[model samples]
Target: MAGVAMQLFISHRVASTDVAMAFMIQSMAFVCFNKVSTAQYFVWYLSWVPLVLPQLVKHSGRQENKGLITAAIAWPFGLAHWLAWAYLLEFQGYPVHLFVWGAGIVFFAINVWCITCLLVRVSSS
Candidate 1:
């Protein structure tokens, strides 16, 4: 799976035990949130965008600033997930849309931060 590959790649890049496990826990959370709509499916994928950077880096075989490039490609999903969460919250409420959106925002923010920090560190090194 892309998610597992992502964890392994990042773990190798930084050699951080905490970062490695964080990806796995997040992957499980994304998987466990079963039975969602099409939009929700994309958002779920977006939530995993941060982890995917390392996988993309590995796949690309680029030697220079690979993580930064992959994070750039993945950035739109993070922004889109935030916007989609907002739209869903306003248009509907039957499915506790507000709660879901809030959760999505939190996930998006965390992933965005993680990816940003990782890319910055990787780039500066």
Candidate 2:
């Protein structure tokens, strides 16, 4: 389901960065809307993250925080790690659901920041 939608989004992109961002955004939305998320869901976006990393690293920006852009893209994985660990602990009868929810909020915010940066980049170009 998510995989098919992700493919459709990625296939329509005309730019390398666009493709990478498409994958990232699609994966984020998929996980957000789904009932359960596994580490494999994170892998879907992490695989494409590297494709966009070099572009961000090489991007020449005067007012942009290249580090923020990078963090925006990378932070989701860290949150995913927490989510996975939290889920593991929860399965062991610990009350750590708040960690999952908090990670989700943070991930969404970081993604929004990345999307804003991308929009600004596109508009300026």
Candidate 3:
């Protein structure tokens, strides 16, 4: 799988923590673009979050980087929204295909924004 290849590439090629963070961002991008992505797929990249959290926190302490912090905070809420819609459609048999699609789009946008903020912070650090 692409994720496995990416992880292996990062492990073998990345010598710096910042570069590893960048690869993690790329992994998140891969999940966003994957047509058949499932909730469990998120674990692939989220597993790196704690490793980079100290860096993120260091960058977020600046007053002007509040937007970055906000995006970080908002991503999970976006995921929850997407999951709620997915659950309704899958389990409740709700006629909400449009809602699910819309939620998916919004979640994707939030994810992209969060990734962008992280990339900026990671690169600038």
Candidate 4:
């Protein structure tokens, strides 16, 4: 978990309330405190990283490379992570389950739908 987390994101600054940092902390706890296995946690973290960053960066000001916003579009996975994790904690042992499944399905589908919409807009431009 720690090894994979080290690569999750790079924030030399104080990192603040970002999802990566949260997962990183949770990863540490799962591995260090609860003795959770690393492989599965790594996969879980990766699946959720995309959904987490934006809210973290909401206070992060602007990206150093504004053009990279498209790439950073993955950050919203953090928001999904927050919501899904909450639902999981309330319902699925906090590890992620069917309750959060809707969140993932919606997030991924909306992701595709939004991307297609954006592409259409760009092309029409």
The collision pairs in model 3 are none
Order of candidates by TM-score, top first?
3, 2, 1, 4
Best by lDDT: 3
Cα deviation at 46, candidate 2, in Å, is: 1.6
Pitting candidate 1 against candidate 3, the one with the higher TM-score is 3
Clashes per prediction? 0, 0, 0, 6
Query: Residue 97 in candidate 3 has what lDDT?
Result: 96
- Residue 17 of candidate 1: its Cα lDDT? 35
The 0-to-1 C-alpha lDDT of every candidate, in the order given, reads 0.52, 0.61, 0.77, 0.44
lDDT per residue for candidate 2 within 54-79, as digits (tens), equals 65556657676564557565775867
Candidate 3 local lDDT, 1-125, one digit each (tens) = 87667556544544355765766777787887688868998998889988877767774547437878788788889999999999999999999999999999999999878767765676566
Candidate 2, position 72, lDDT = 67
Candidate 1 residue pairs in clash (backbone atoms < 3 Å)? none
- What TM-score number comes out for model 2? 0.55
- In model 4, residue pairs whose N, Cα or C atoms come closer than 3 Å (at least 3 residues apart or on different chains), thus clashing, are 50-77, 51-76, 51-77, 51-78, 52-77, 52-78
lDDT of 4 by residue, 1-72 (tens): 654554343222113434354554344333323323223444544565455545434434343324236534
Better lDDT candidate (1, 3): 3
TM-scores, all candidates, are 0.33, 0.55, 0.79, 0.31
Between 1 and 2, whose TM-score is larger?
2
